[model samples]
Each structure stands twice: as structure tokens, then as C-alpha cells.
Target: MAARPIIRFPDPRLRQKAEPVVAFDAELRSLAKDLTEAMLAAPGIGITAPHIGVLRRLVVLRLESDAAAQAYLNPEIVWFSPETIRHVEGSVSMPGVNEEIERAARVRVRYQDLDGVEHEEEAEGLRAVCHQHEIDQLDGIFWIDRLSKLKRDRLIKKFEKLQRLGA
Candidate 1:
């Protein structure tokens, strides 16, 4: 599969909610593959269908460079630990800038596989953060929305500067 072009930051599609995926067919698999390829090419550990302007509830995560990419369909965080942790988060769509954001330290996520098989998984640390981040994106919440207004404003300005510099 080939990497699809990623929708960049400030694109209105990034703010639009993704539709739930209903089919567990070859086309779905192909889209997952394309997402994985696009993520790898972007040097990002995670990405979603919406990153490429395809508003489907799908996410692909490769937590480590050598690890196999995992695809999740219609992923939702069913539970979140009261304990929180802060981690630097960035987006494939919003390149060249990142900010530290607080998120649940652990989470239980219910999601379907590429074949539409439902599964639940517990995640902690970085995995947990990624789940919440991606799920938020699926819900039309950009990562910066998690930050303080001052922080979000600063980050957006920085991102805009980078864009002007062609970074």
C-alpha cells in the first residue's frame, strides 16, 4: 500500500468528527495499510484516517520504530485512570510543533480490529496517552485543545511560523 497525502494542520477536516467504520472488508484493510504507510513516512508513531481527509474512525499506531503497526477501528476509551501523566504530543497533520499535555496514565479502550472483531485492551504510559489522543482526534478534538488557552495560542503561532519558513 502507498502512503496517502496527509491533511495538514488548519484544514477544516481536522476538526470534523470521523464517521464510524461499519465494514470489515478489503477496502478497510487497504485504508489501514495506507494509514500505516503514511504514518511511517511521516515519522510519526500514530495516525488516523482523518489525517488524510478520510473521516473514518480508524487509527494506526507504531509505538516503536521496530514494532508492528497496530490498527484500531472505531476505538473508544471506555475508562480512564484518575491518575494523570504529562507527555509531549504532536500530530502528523500538525507537523514541526508539539506540546506537553496531561492525560490519563492508564486507560481501557474498546475497539474493533481491521476485521471488525471487537476487543478491549488496557494501556498505560505512552500507550494510554496515544489512545486518548487519537480517540480525541476521532471525536474532532485536536490535541492542542487539551492545552491551556495561552499554550494553545502560543503553539499555533509557532506552528504557523514554521509553516511560513517551510519547515
Candidate 2:
């Protein structure tokens, strides 16, 4: 599988909700592989199909570089702990800046494997953060939306400046 091009911030597709993955076929597996490759190329720990312009509720996460990547299909948060934690978060689509965002410290996520087998898992700390972040992406909510308007505006300006300089 090859890494696909990632859509950048402000792309309308990023704001559009992703459709659920209905097929548990080779194509879905291939997409999972592609997402994993693209995420590694982006040097990101988590990614969603929407990041690559595929409107599918699919996510790939590899919290540790040396660890194997895990793919989640149609993932949804089933429960969240009241305890919250603030972590710095960024997006592959919006590459140059990150903001501290508050999220559930623990979560119970219900998702399906590539084979369409349903599974539920509990996560905390970074894993929990990644789950919420990517799930928000799947729902067309950019990570910056979690920030204050002032912070979001400042971060977008910074990102735009980075893009101009990089170009």
C-alpha cells in the first residue's frame, strides 16, 4: 500500500463529516494500510480517513513509533470519564502549530476491526486523547475547534505564515 496525499487545513473536506465504512473487504484493508503509511509519513501518531480526503469513518493510530499501528473502523466513543486532562494537540492537516486542549482523561471506545469484528477498549492519557482527537476529526471537527476563539485565530495565522514561508 502507498501513502496517500493528505488534505491540508481549511480544506472544505476537513469540515465535512465522514461516512461510515460499510464494507469489510480488501479495499478497506488497503485503505487502512494507506492511512498508516500516510500517518507515518506525516510523522503523526493518529490519522483519520478524512485527512486523506476519504470520507470514511476510519482511523489509524500508532502511539509509539516502534509499535504496530492499529486501525479502527466506524469508531465511536461510548463513554468518557468526568476527569479531564489538557494535552497539546495538533493535526496532520494543520502541521505547523498545536494548542493545549482539554479532553477526557479516560474513554471507552467502540470500534470495529478491519474484519468488521466489533471491539471495545478503554484508554487513558495519550491514547485517550488520540481517540477523542481522531474521533472529532471523523465528525468533521478540526482540533483547533477545541481551542478558544482567540487561540484558534492566532494558531491559524501562525499556520498560514508557516505555509507562506514553506512555499
Candidate 3:
């Protein structure tokens, strides 16, 4: 498996909704493997297909320190808890800055495995946060979207300046 380059924020491709994986064939499996490798290489807990320029409904996540990495195909959150929790989230796409975002404390997700078997899993705590974040990426949403308009604008301006400086 190879590491795929992650597309950064402000790229139009990141705003495009991903397509569903119609066949659970070898190509799909290989893409998932490459995605997993890319996530691990980036030292991140979660990654979505769109982040690597693949417009497919796929995600890779490993929340627990000792848990094995898992890939999700056509993943979607089917249930969410009333309880809410807030955490500071950062992204590989954004690099240094992080923003506080509120998310559901618990969630139930339905997704397909490598073998194309459907499964529903309940997640809580950091796992829940990771799932929610990755799901948003599949929908072309970024963590900065959760910030206030003013704050989002300021951060974008900062990134733009950084880009201009060739940094």
C-alpha cells in the first residue's frame, strides 16, 4: 500500500460530495489499503477518501491506541446521542491551527467492511468524535465549518497569507 497525498483546505475538490462505491472489488480494497497507509503515515486517527482526491464514500479510522485500523465503505452515522461534548480539533489539511467544536458524545454508524459485509457499530468518546469528523469529510465538510463565520474568515485569511509567503 502507498501513501496518498492529502488535499488541503480551500481546494475546490474538498467541497465535492463523494460517490458511493458500487463494487467491492479489488480496486476498492486497494484504495482502502492505501488510505489506511496514508492515515498512518500522517499519524492521524481518521481520514476520508476525498482528503486524498478520491471521490468515494470511504474512511479509515483507528481510535484506540492498541486497536487495529479499520476501513469503512459507504459509512454513515445512523444514530447520535443527545449529550454533547466539545473538543479542540486540528486537521492535516489545516496544519497548525485547531478549533473547538461541539459534537455528539455517542453515535451509531453503519458501514461496510473490506469483504463488503454491512455492520453497525456504536462508538463513544474520542471514537465518536473521530467518526463524526471523518463522516463530515465524506460530505465535503471541514472542521473550520463548525467555527463562527468571523473566526472562519480570519483563519482563512491567515492561511492565505501563509500561502502568499510561500510557506
Candidate 4:
């Protein structure tokens, strides 16, 4: 497996909606492995295909304690709890910045596994947050999108300047 480069924010590809997987073939399976490697190289807990310019409805998530990686294809949130929790979230695409956001404390997600088997799993805490974040990527949304317009604009400007300075 190879580590794919992550596309950063402000890239137009990040705004495009991802396509669903039509078949769970060898290529898709290999892509899942590559995604896991990429996520691990980024040292991140979760990653979506869009981050690597695949534009496919795929995501890989591995918590610090997990021995095996988890792959989700065409994942959708079927249920979410009314209770919310706030946590500091960061993205490898938007490096060096983290912001606090409120998210559902629990969620039930349905998705196809690497072998084409469909499964539904309930998640909470960091796992739930990771699922939500990856699902947002599939929908062409990012964590910063949850911020107020003013805050979002300020962050864009900051990142833009950083880019200009090659920082």
C-alpha cells in the first residue's frame, strides 16, 4: 500500500460530491489499503477518498487502539442522537489549526465493507466524530463549514497568507 497525498482546503475537488462504489473489486480493495496507509502517514484517525482526489464514497478510520483498520464504502448516517458534544477537531488537509465544534454524541452508520457486505454500526465519542467528519467529506463539506461565516473567512485568510509565505 502507498500513502496518497492529501488534498488541502480551497481545492475545488474538495467541493465535488463523491461517486458511490459500483462494485467491490480488487481495485477498490487496494484503494482501501492505500487509504489506510495514507491516513496512517498523516497520523490521522480518519480519512475520506476525496482527500486523495478519488472522488469516491469511501473512507478509512482507525482509532489509536484498533489493531485492524476499518473501511467504509458509501457510508451514510442512519441515526443520530439528540444529545450533542463539543470537541476540538483538526484536519490533515487544514494543517496546524484546530477548532471546537458541536456534533451528535452518537450515530448509527450503514455502509458496505471491503468485501461488499453491508453493515450498520453504532458509534460514540471520538468514533462518532470521525464518522461524521468522513461523511462530511463524502458530501463535499468540511469541519470549517460548521463555523460562522466570519470565523470561516478569517481562517481562510490566515491559511491563504500562510500559503503565500510558504509556511
By descending lDDT, how would the candidates be arranged?
2, 1, 4, 3
Q: Model 4: how large is the Cα RMSD against the reference? A: 1.4
Specify the highest-lDDT model's number: 2
Residues forming the 10-long window of minimal summed lDDT in candidate 2:
60-69
Model 2 ranges off by over 4 Å: none
Candidate 3 TM-score, C-alpha based: 0.91
Give the TM-score ranking, best first. Answer: 2, 1, 4, 3
Model 3, total clashes: 0
**Per-model C-alpha RMSD:** 1.2, 1.2, 1.7, 1.4
Candidate 4: minimum summed lDDT over ten consecutive residues — where?
90-99
Give, for candidate 1, the lowest lDDT window spanning 10 residues: 59-68
Candidate 1, residues 65-146, lDDT tens digits: the string is 4359999999998899999999999999889999999999999999999878899999999999999999999999999999
Q: What is the lDDT of residue 50 in candidate 1?
A: 95
Per-residue lDDT tens digits of candidate 2, residues 1-167?
45799999999999999999999999999889999999999989999999999999999999874369999999999999999999999999999799899999999999999999999999999999999999999999999999889999999999999999993
For each candidate in turn, the TM-score is 0.97, 0.97, 0.91, 0.94
lDDT tens string, model 4, 21-77?
988999999898888888899878889998888999999999987898899999999
Question: Worst 10-residue stretch by lDDT in candidate 3?
Answer: 90-99
